[model samples]
Target: MDQPITRRDFLNGIAIGATAAAASGPLLAASMPDPAARALPGASPLPPAAQDAFGYYPPLLTGLRGSHPGSFEDAHALRDSHTWPTATDTGQEYDLIIVGGGISGLAAAHFYRAQAKTESRILILDNHDDFGGHAKRNEFNLDGHLNILNGGTLEIDSPRPYGPIAANLLTTLGVDVPKLIKTTQNLEFYQSLGLQSGVFFDRETFGADKLSVGLERGPLKELLAQAPLSAAARAAIVQIQEGNIDYLPGLSSDEKKQRLSRMSYEAFLRDVVHVEPAVLNFYYARTMGEWGVGTDAVSALDCWGIGLPGFQGMNLAKGSIRRMGFTPAGYEDTGGSFRLHFPDGNATIARLLVRNLIPSAVPGSSAEDVVTARVNYAQLDRDAAPVRVRLNSIAIRARHIGDPKSADQVEVTYLRGGQAFTTRARGVVLAGYNMMIPYLCPELPAAQKDALHKLVKTPLVYTSVALRNRQAFDTLKVHRVYAPGSFHTYFHLNPHVHVGRYESPKSVNDPILVHMVRTPCKRGLPEHEQNRAGRAELLATSFETFERNIREQLGRTLAAGGFDPARDITAITVNRWPHGYAPEYNPLFDPDVPEAERPHVVGRARFGRIAIANSDSGGAAYTDTAIDQGHRAVVELLQG
Candidate 1:
């Protein structure tokens, strides 16, 4: 007899609840505009200039940046209301229903096919406008030539270390590791062109805009010499680099480890390392890029783990300190080698998978040709296809059809274009995110739900700016610049890559895309709280603000190199991921617990007719983790 809640009412309730929650705290009240609000309007016409010669307008370029409006609205409403409108039965059924269309989700479909050994019906439902979730491709056309760059999920680092399942998946997808290595960045070429690592200190942070290059000779000494710091601070840095630690006379290995884990890197730098405020400021942004938090929040052990120098007289291995240099050990040994990249980064992997799953969706036969193949979006969800990928469809509710003990089927209800549709599946894979799983499947155990919520995703921004030419970068004699105090922590000209028909910029006058990376983390906050704060800040940021920051930062830092922000800059695409990186073990906060006892491990346990698959579930952000988890989820679903 109760009236079903309308979608409008559900959305309104979410807005009202958010308003009430915001009213309770100033920080919450200051949160940015709903990302959905900034999405391109449904009726708006696409600008002709926005479309390239390839007839594609990259989503990041067209104002619809992050998660689309319909996607976020449905997910937010379902999470808030704890209910949904009655779903209209679509009379469609599948052997497997994967909730996300990211690397994990696509890999799930691949694994499911392999496990079943049959062309079973499978559906991949994604909320994004494009199929590849974070492994997105950003294509730019300059004077009729298309330049492709990755909007997210850039590289496959050392694929040799990947698990068996992941390695198998890559092999199955026609990804040749040896070929990828051969086609990756030509670091020797860059070095030959006077390209070297440099650091830029902003005027606001250092009293003067200064650029220091060639830090590999003596990173700490060179940095301190050029950095705006007191004589005492400079002396302290040099002393630390040279292994002078009279502060800690004698401490046992156990005692040192315990102390380092408990104490923050900032405290260790100021109190133990005896560095000044300016030194801490320089390190803040650098640390955030790696650990998603500043030195004040990250433990000293974690800082050391990522090769940040500070520890001395702790009997830390000599190789550890040497490895923390400007070039690092593995990188320098291999001439700065990065593995597995297409012209558009890892998006090629996703494209390859899509092509294999639904051969009609893309016109390509090999990895080389996939780079330039045109995707047939219209054919993604054909009824006749054994595998279907449905984009812009957000899965809201997933629940068991009957008793968990005997139920052989699960029902997934998703929202698309303001309409709710239901479909049945023999098995389900929750591959979107760890935290969202609890809300999507409320029938899960309370402990599992709590554990699922505990895994917080790190927020990040990977902004790709298309430049008119690389004159400024060439003039600066650097391909990469580390800006510790700028809005963007690091900016670099994407390394030249030649694969198939696509070739990165070869000449200085050629148009190029500069990749900028930023991780937003609040200092002095707990890890999870810092992630939450960062997410809030990411959602609040507008494209206009991002553009302004990019323009100002680039102009100020690259002025000496003959860079003009207005004339040289052609396009800007900000890939703002509120939930960017997967949850990794925090040495500072997370206890040294067994693998089976970890929250992600327990949270990912298979429930009735459903299994979890994602990088988060595996507790690592690597592409291999996603593939491995996908294989595990499909295997678990099949065995049960």
Candidate 2:
């Protein structure tokens, strides 16, 4: 199963967000609890030492991912209250040492090698068991064939066209997005099978557990007739979807858009369009998957930008809106970008980069062959490799060797196994969480540090379930479902993708992977606050809770189709991203500030020999942004 589909998670998951924290904020430690009380219900048992030692294969590992255990304990301890750890010098040095092994970090390494000397040794330290940051690839071997799905970043896409640097980077990696999409994706497979998009109204939220198929393709009358919505809601939905009367009739397109930019999508529907409250459920989850905030938290302009209903009559021009020193990306953001999702999503990009940077790590020479190539994790951090990627290594501190203005080298102290080791580098790139940068390098200016702290990431989960078969979905004629009230708001059978040497299941009896998405956000709070609350909720949620909800929701939604959760689920991988999507700018909650003064911009400014890079630093949750940021960070350092 694919993890919570991020907007870039391929299908463009941006949905309604609302859900209060069930437990206290994870950072504030004094809440109270014994060891047993605090233990996560389904916290995975520590794998054997050898498993992570030389046989480290994280793609095959299932269960909790995306900030898995032993990954964040040190960072948390340091964040709670800074206690710098003393380190034993490793007598090792590098030209560059990147603190993240995600896309941006890998790209930084690739760029550094290209510009610097060929023998310039670079090291990428990551806390996770595997690299690629949020672009995670999950693998499941059933009987003989392998089932693969992305646990995180899913597509080489964005709201707008990829800039030259990012676009050229993909081409250089042998990833022809258009060519790959044609060769790998089967968009008509579900259509041929007569399946369509649907909604599952649970009894708790809709008064009855019902599945309504073809909500987009089939007759709207059938859905209206079957929905347990109030009569007023039914009529309102029809008017919104099919009617043409403009709510903001008198205002010009720009004026209407300006007003929309300042309000939430929910307000546009309820107060402006005069829709009944019950109608919100039908459209709530659409925005949740993208930013983890519901219609109430999202800008009305954004709803219109994404083709949400009730906007046709307004006749707003297909463009952007600027108000109060900010530009809303709704209409302006959606444009051309090649969409390509590999068998393992953007992890193919990571593997391709790894292959380019560290020769034999991923053997294949082309992006096509990389789909089925098993990575040699053992070779990742070899001493002989000029560019080494060290996993399961948490960098506790990255500080300049001396004064702010004069330091030419940096010291990076990290915890791997149980001891602290220090490595020196000519320059360093902090490519991890933007919010955590303040803790890593405390010597930065107070305002810069403060700016970095404001980049709060939205928390979410991407769950993948390996099923015995997709009979339930096929029977119900639903390739996807939108369940607003369910724990997982959206789920679907992964589209059949045949690429390289890998092929998706072709038979109804063949095993399939179902992907589910959950963005836990609290209502009423501002966007950043909502994201913070969502992160806390995700941190407190147990895999047991996740699994139970998965079973219950699937059972209820697919019962009519004879789906049996207990018997059909062969495996489950819950990719919990407590700090999920990189915080994107939102006109509703974020302050209207000049572009250069924005948190991402101010925070990303180079500090001496240190530079920042990541999608977070760019304030856009897309692969292109990460690549762009990485290139920029590298260029800044090289120029100096």
Q: Give RMSD to native, each candidate.
A: 10.2, 6.5
The positional error of residue 138 in candidate 1, measured at the CA in angstroms, is 1.0
Worst 10 residues of 2 by lDDT: 26-35
Over the full model, what C-alpha lDDT does candidate 1 score relative to the true structure? 0.71
Write model 1 residue lDDT over 217-299, tens digit each, in one string. Answer: 44567666887767777776566556635444487654665576677888888887767887777666645654566678777
Query: What is the Cα-based lDDT of residue 249 in candidate 1?
Result: 48
TM per candidate comes to 0.85, 0.92
lDDT by residue (tens digit), candidate 2, 64-172: 7778877888899889985655777888889999999999999999998888755799989999888999999988887578999989887876777888989999999
Instruction: Give the distance in Å from residue 75's predicted Cα in candidate 1 to where it truly belongs.
Output: 1.7
Candidate 1, residue 584: the lDDT equals 74
